[model samples]
Target: MRKAPLASLATVGVIATEDVHSNTSVQQALASSRSLRSVTAPALITPRSDGRARATRTANFVSGQTAFAPTGVRLAFSYARQSEEFPDGIRRQHEENARVAAGLGFAIPDTPEFRYSDDETSGRLKSRDAFNRMLDRIASESKPASALFIRERSRIGRWNDPRRHDYYAVYFADRGVPIVESCDPQWVDWDNDTSDEVTLRFLHSTLKSIQSRNERIEIVKRTNRGTRAHIKQGFYSLKAPYYATDRWVAWAHTREPILKLDPGVSYVREGCAIILRWATDGSVQVVRDIFGWILGGRSLGWIAAELTRKCVPPPGARYNTARVDGPWHKELVRKIARNPIYRGDLLYGRTSQRFRGQEAVLAPQAQNDAFGKILYLDFLSDPPLSRGDFEAVQERLEANLYQHEARSRTKRNYPLSGVLVCASCRRGLHGFGSAPNRVGQVRTYYRHSMTRGEGSQCPHENRYIAAAPVDSALVNIVHDALASDRLQQLVASEVTRYLDDPRQRRRAEERHACASEIRELERELGRLSEELGQCTQSHWERSLRSRKDRIVSKLEALEAVGATLAQEDARLAAIERGLAHQEAYSATLYTLYGQAPTLVQRRVHEGLIEAVHVDFASRQVLFTTRSSTLGAEACGD
Candidate 1:
C-alpha cells in the first residue's frame, strides 16, 4: 500500500493503526515524531500498530486551523532509503586486537572520549568491524576527529603484519589526524641518553608488542599440540564445523558427536566412517583380491574394472566419511595396494596439508620445525596382512617399474646366467640368441667370446654349449646338493668369511649402542620413579604419571628393537660356531641357498661350483667343487 510521505503526513491528519506488536519500534517512531513535532507542531498524530498504519490516516478538526507542513519541519520518522546519521558522541580508541589475542592490555588511556573495542578477533588481518567504524567516524568531516590512543601496537594490530596498523598513526598524523599511542611500562621505562625522542618513545612498546604477539602464537601452538596429543587418545582435535559434517558427522537422530577417526580405535554404530568395525569382513576379501590381482600381474585398470564388475564397493565407497557411493578408478586400486594400514605398518611425515594464504595445499612435511610439525599414526584393526607377504608384494611392485636398464637385466629372470662358466677358457659364458627352450623351436647357446667374432678359426675346445642342457644340469645339481649334507657344509664355509664382514661388525656395534641406551633409559626411569614417589599433589602426580607413561612407551619400543637384534646376533653366532662341523655347515648352506636371490646364486656358484662342463658327444657332465682338491664328479647320460 502507498502511504503518505512522513513529511506530507505532518500537514494532513490521518488515522493509522498503532503497531502494538512491536513496542520498541512504536516507541522509536513515537519518539521520532515527538522530536519532529518539537521543531514544528504540524499535526496531532498517534502511532498505530502498523506505524501503527499511515501517520496521516486520521483527520480531525482542532481549533478550526488548516495546517500546511513547511520544508524546515523535522519529522521523527525514518525510511527504508534514508535514515538519521549521528555519532554516539564518544572519542575513544582501543588497541583491542592485542587485547584479545594476547590479553596484553585491558585498560585504555584516560584521554580519549570513547574507545572502540574489537573483542575476540584474529590479528591475521584488519577484520574488526569496530576498528573500521572508528576510522570512518574519525575520517568524517563533520567531527573532523584528530587523535586516537592505543595501549600498544599489538593491542591495535598484529606486529607481524606491520602494514595493518602502522599506517593508522602515520597516514592520519600527516593529514592532521595524529593517533596518540600511550606506551606501557616497558616503553615508558626504556629511555637512554643516546636515544632520539621518537626512538625512545616507541622502542619499548614496539619490542613488547612483538613479544605479546609471539606469546599469543606460542600459546596457540601449545594448545594445538595438546589437542593433537588428545587425538592420539582416540578423540578429535578439530571441532565439529557445520560445513565439515562429512569429516565430523553424527548419524541421523543419534547422540554421537562424529566419526571415530582415530585409526585402530573401533566404534560400531549405525553411521558411516564412524562405525569402525573393520575387522575380518568383506573388506578383507576386497583388499586381498586387490593386492592378489596386483601381485598376479594385473594392471590397476584391470583390477578396478574387474572389482566393479564383481559388484565390489571400493575402499572409500563404504568407509569414507562422506559415505558417497561411486565407481572405482585406477588410482583407488593403486593407493589401496600401497596403503601400509592393511599391512599393520605405520608411517608418518610423508606429507602435510595446511592453508597457505587463501589456498589449501599439500607440501613436504616439516624439516625440523618444532612448532608446526605433526605426526599421524594408525592402529591395527585385525587380521592384518603378514609382513613377509606385504614386503614381497612391495618388492614385486618395485621390480615391475619400467626403466632404461630394466629389460636388459637378466639376473632375476635367468638365475643361472652369470653362474655358469666356460670349461675350456674358464671365462663367464654369455647367453645369447633365442631364449633357451627344450623343444628346440629356437636355439639359445652359452657361447665363449672366440666363437662370436670373425676371427681366425683358432678355437678353444668345446667353446659353445647349449643353454637348455646347462640350465637343466645346473637345476639338478642344486637339488641334489641341497638334498645332502654337502650343501650345508658349503653354506657354513661361505658364511664364515662374513662373520667379520664390515656390515656385520656395524650391526653388532649398533646392537651394543642399543643396549647402552636401554640401560641409560632404565636408570633415568628409576630416577623419575623416585621423584614421582615424592610428589603429593594430585595434579603434580598426574603430570608425573603422564611423563612416566610416555617414557615407558619409548622404553617398550627400544626393548622390542633390542630383543630382535639380540636374537639375530645369537643366531649368527650359532651359525659361526657350527661351521666347525662339515655336516652342520652343509645344512646351513642348504637353508641359505634355498632362501637366496639370483645374485646370491651367482655368488654360490662362484664360491663352490668352480666350473661346469657338458660334452654333447659323450652325453656326460663333469663338475668340480671347491669342497676339496679331489672334488670332481662326472655324470654320464
Candidate 2:
C-alpha cells in the first residue's frame, strides 16, 4: 500500500514538471491535472481498507491535537407538586439549570431527552414518572452524565425522612455523577478527595435535608391546627356528607346561610363555615325508607338488591353522574344505616390521618365521648329517624354483626374444608352435603369452588371427592404423628420456636394494651352511666346515654379481642402439656376425634394441617403440616 501511494505521488510530480517546460496549453493541462490530484489524493490513501493504519493515524492526530477540550455533559430534572405551579415553575427551573450548566463550562443537550419534568407530582412520593425515567436513563446509558442539575436539593425530594432525601445525592455521587443545585452558590466537587471539602459538602447536604424536613413538618402542623379549629367551629371538614344531606355555606359566627353548594362544589370563603342540611329532593324520602327497612328486619344485602332493582340512585350519584346507574352495594346501605347524620347529629374525628411511608392513610381511632366530638345541628325540619329509632338501628346492627360472626363460624363444616386444595387451579375445595337417604346417612363431598360456577375456570374433569375418606386420612395422619416420638420432638421444637417469635410477643403486647384500654373504657362508661342517672335535662340525659352506649360498644370490641388472645394462649398451653404426657393426651384426642362435632373436627384440622393438595390425575394426596421444617409427605388415597 505504501509503495503504490508513493509511486502515484511521483508520477504526478513528474507530469507537473514536464508540463511546466511545455507551451501555455500544456501548462493549462498541468494546472487542470493538479486540481484533480488535489481533489483525489486524500481519497487514494484512505484508511478505510486497513484497521492498523487507521489506529496509527488516529494516535498521531490525537498526539498533535491542542485546539479544543471536551466539556462535561449536564442533565436537568424539574418537579412541581401542583398543576397550577407548572410551566412557570418547570420553565424557570430548566432555564436556571441551563444557565448554571453554561457557567460551569458544561454542555446541556438541547433535546428533551436530557430534560425531565414531573409536573403536578409530589417530590415526597417515592414513585414519579419523569423522575424514575431520568434515573433509568442514567443507570442504563453507555456514557454517564458528569452532573445532574436541579433548582435546589429539595427539587430531588422532600422526603419525610431526612436520610431518604440525602439518598439521591449519595447515589449520584457514588456513580461518579454529582448532583448540582443551581440555586446553591457553593457547588460540591465530588471528584476531589480532599477531606475538608467532602465534609463541608456532606454537612451542607445534611443541613438542607433537615431544613426541608422541618419545613414539611411545620406545614403539616399548621394544616392540622387549622383543620382542628375548623372542626371545633362546627364546620364540616371531611368529604361531602352522606346521601340526602346537602352542604350549605354560612357565616362562621352568625350561622347565616350564604348559599346551598351544588354537589361536588367544595369552595368556601375564608369567613364562611359549611353546614349540613337535609335536601328538599326525594333523596330524603329514600333515606327514611332505608332506615325503616333496616328497622323492619330487612338485611343490608336485601335492601341493596331491592334499591338496585328499583333503579334508585346510590350514594354519591349527585357528585358523579356515572354512579347514577351504578348498582347499590350493601356497604352503601350499611353506611347510611350507621351514620348519626341521619338523626340530625354531626360526628367527626372517628378516624385520624397518618402517613405510611410516602402514602397518606386514614386509620380508625377508638371513639369515646371526648374524642368522638359529636355536634347537634338542626339539619332537617324533621329528621329521618328519631333518637330512639336510631338507637334501635344501632342495636339491630350489633345483632347483625354477631349473627354474621356465628354464620362464618358454622359456614365450613367439613374437617378438610379449607385444607383441601385442587392441584390444577390451586383453589380451595368447598364442602357440600347431600340430603339423607332412606338409611338416614348424609353424604358429604368436597368440590372445587369454581367447578359449577357460571363462568367456571377449573380445567380438571374430576372435581368432586368424598369428604369422609379425606377426613379419615387426615385423622389417621394426626394420630400417627401423635404416637411417633420424632413427631413429638418436632412439635415441641416448633411450639417453643413459635412461642419465642417476635410476632407472638407483639401479639401479647397488643393484648395487654387492649386490656388496659378496656379497663379505662369501663371506668368511662360507669361515669357516663352515673351522669345519665343524675341528669335532669332530657338533652343532657340523651347525650350521657349516647356516650355510655359508645363506651359499652368499645368495651365489647376490646373484650372480644382479649378473649380471642386468651383462647390462643390457652390452646398453646394445652398443646404443650399434651406433648409432655403423650399417653393420656393421645387417648383424649382419640376419644374427642370419635365423638366431636363437625365444627370441633374442623378446628382440629386447621390447627394441625397447612394444606392438602389433591391431584386427581396422579391419584396422590399431599399433606403439608403446620411445621414448615417437617416439609410435605405424599400418600395414596
Candidate 3:
C-alpha cells in the first residue's frame, strides 16, 4: 500500500481556500494513495476555520496572478426615481454615482455585468429588476464579491420600516461582502476588526434610514398641501374628469377659457388653471338618457345591456384602448347614476390613500365650498338632470338597494320550486305556468331547466309533468312516511349516528375552541381598555387603544362564527326532537300539511323531502330523505 503525502494534503487545504486551480497536486496525491482511491475530490477541500483570514488570502492569491477573481470584483448599483418635476433625474443620478465612485478610489466597470441600475424606479418599492439581478449574481458566484458600491446609504432602500431597510445590508455582510456607501463619511468594511468602528457604521446607517423616512413624510405633506390649495382654487386635481365632462385650461385670475383640452391631454402652465366643463359631444345626451332611463323604472342591468347593444362607449373608454368596445357592466351604470357631479356639485375627499399601502380608506367628503364647490361653473348651461329628477333617481336607487320595492312586484308561487328533480339528467326541474284557457284555468308544469344545452342530455327533454299531480304525490308520500313506524326508527337511528360521528364531534370541539378564544380576547380587551383609561402618556394610551380595538374586532368575528355554529346545533337538535317523538309530531304534521297554503306547503316540502326524482317513462317517483329514499307511483295527468 502506497502512503499518502502529508505535505500535499496541507498544500491542498491551503490552495482550496484561495482557488480551485491548486487541485492538480491533490489529484496526484489521491492517485498515489491506494486507500484514498474511493475518496472524492471535494473531500480533501474543506472550508478554512477563520473567515477573515481566508478572504485576505484569497484576495492575495488572485492579485498575484492574471486569472479572473470574484473577490477582487466590486459591483456597483445605482437607482434613479423619475417624475414630472424631474425628467432628467436618471441621467443626473448616473453622473453623480460615477463621480462618487471615483472619489472613493473605486472604478465601476462600464459593462452591464459589473454595473447595475434601476431607472425610473422608487427606492421605497421592494421589487427592482437590476437590484434582484445583482443579488442573484452574487449568490450564485463561487467566490463572493469584496464590496458592493452605491451612491449613498439611502440608495439601498428608503423603506418605511427600518427592519426591511437593514435586511439587504445584513444579507451582504453575512456573505463576507460589505456595502460601501461612497457618500457616507463613516463607511466601514465588513472585515473591520474594531467594534467601535462597526458600531459607528451601524448607527450611521440607522440615522440615514430614519432621515430618509422623515424626508419622504415631509414630501408627502408638502404635496398634499399643494394639492388641497389647488383644489380650493377650483382646479381639477384628483384625476380625469367624469364622463360627459371635459378638462379645460383657463386663466387663473380672469377665469377665461384659454383652450379646450382633448381627452387624456395634460400640461402645466404658469398662469393657467384646469377646470371641468360640459362636453359638446353626443356623450352628454347619453348621460341625460341614462338619468332619464333610471327614473323611468328601468333596471341597472337592463340599462347596461341596452347601452352595450347600442355600442355606446362607457366611462374611461377613451383611455382604455383594450376595453373601448367592451360591454357595459351594471356596476358602471350604477356609478354613473350615483355621482353628484352631474347634479352641478363637485365631490372630493371621499376616500384617502395611505402612504404605507395602496388601498384607499374612506374619508368624509368635504362639506364646505372651499374644496367641494366648482368656481368656474355658473350653472348657465343645463345640468345633466334637474335637481328634482336627480333627487328622485337617488331615492329610486336607494329603494332598489334595500329591496323595499321588491314587495310591490307580483310574485308567482311554486310549491316544488327546488324539490322536483329530473331522474334522467339529475337536474332540478323549474315550474312554468301557462296562460289561462277559455275556462279560466291555468296549467303549471315542471320541466328540466335546460332542455337542450352543453350539459348532460335528458332522455325526456321535451316531456313536461303537470305540477299539481307531482306536488300532490310528494305531499302524500311525505305524510305516509311520517306515519310509518319503520321510517321513525330509521330516522332516529340515522340522526343518532350523525350526532355521534367523529366529524360532528370535531365541529363541536371547534365551536368550543372558538368560544374559548373569544373569552380570552374579551379578557384581553377589558385589560387593555382599563390600561388605556388610566395611561398618562399619550403614546402608551394610543398603543393600548389600538390593541383594544384589534381584540374587539377579533371578538366580534368569533361571536359571529359562534352564532353560526349555534344555529347549526339548533337545527340538528330540532330534527332529533321531532324524530324522537315521531308519533305526536307525525300526527300534527300530517293534519296541517294537507290544509297548508302554497307558501307553507313549499316550506314543508323543503323540510321533509331532500329531492323528488321523477322517471316519466317508468311512471315512478323516488322521494329522497336525509338518510333514506321512499318510492311511490306517479299520479296520471
TM-scores for all predictions: 0.26, 0.45, 0.48
TM-score head-to-head 1 vs 3, winner: 3
TM-score of 3: 0.48
Query: C-alpha displacement of 260 in model 3, angstroms?
Result: 4.9
- In candidate 3, position 28 carries an lDDT of 32
Q: Could you give candidate 3's per-residue lDDT for residues 1-637 as a string of tens digits?
A: 1222223221111111222333333323223233222222222233345432211111111121111335433334443344233566656656676566444333455666656777645677777888788778666545333446666666666667866667877786555444655454123333422445456766877888899888766666676666656665667764477888888889999868888886656668999888788887788898889999998988787688778767788786877877766778788888888876777755454323332334222223322322222223332256777778888999999977755343224255667766777777777877776654566466777866542212444667646777787767676767776777766677678888988889987889999999999889888887887777789999888888777778788889999999999999998888777765778867886888778888787776665667678787786667666444343333333
Model 3 misplaced stretches (Cα beyond 4 Å) = 1-78, 83-85, 94-164, 171-193, 259-266, 298-310, 353-381, 403-637
Compared with the true structure, what per-residue lDDT tens digits does model 2 show for residues 580-629? 67677557667877688987777766766777898978866778777633
1-637 per-residue lDDT for model 1 (tens digits): 2222233222222222233332333222222343244222222234355444322222221212221224321111000100112132122123332232122111223222234555445554455666666666555553322234454455555535444454655555443333433343111111111224336446644565567567667666776665545334333334221111123334634425464343323333443223223433366667777778777877676676666656665555434645343557787777666666566533332223442223211123333223343333333335346767777777766755532144334332344454555444455556654432455344566655432212232244325666676667666666566545555555665787788788988988888998898899898899889989898899988988898898899899999999999898999988777766666544565688868987787776666576666444464556666654225464523
The lDDT, on a scale of 0 to 1, for candidate 2 is 0.63
Error of 1 at 524 (Å): 99
Q: Highest TM-score, which number?
A: 3
Q: TM-score for model 1?
A: 0.26
- In angstroms, how far off is 272's CA in candidate 2? 3.4
Instruction: Quote model 2's TM-score.
Output: 0.45
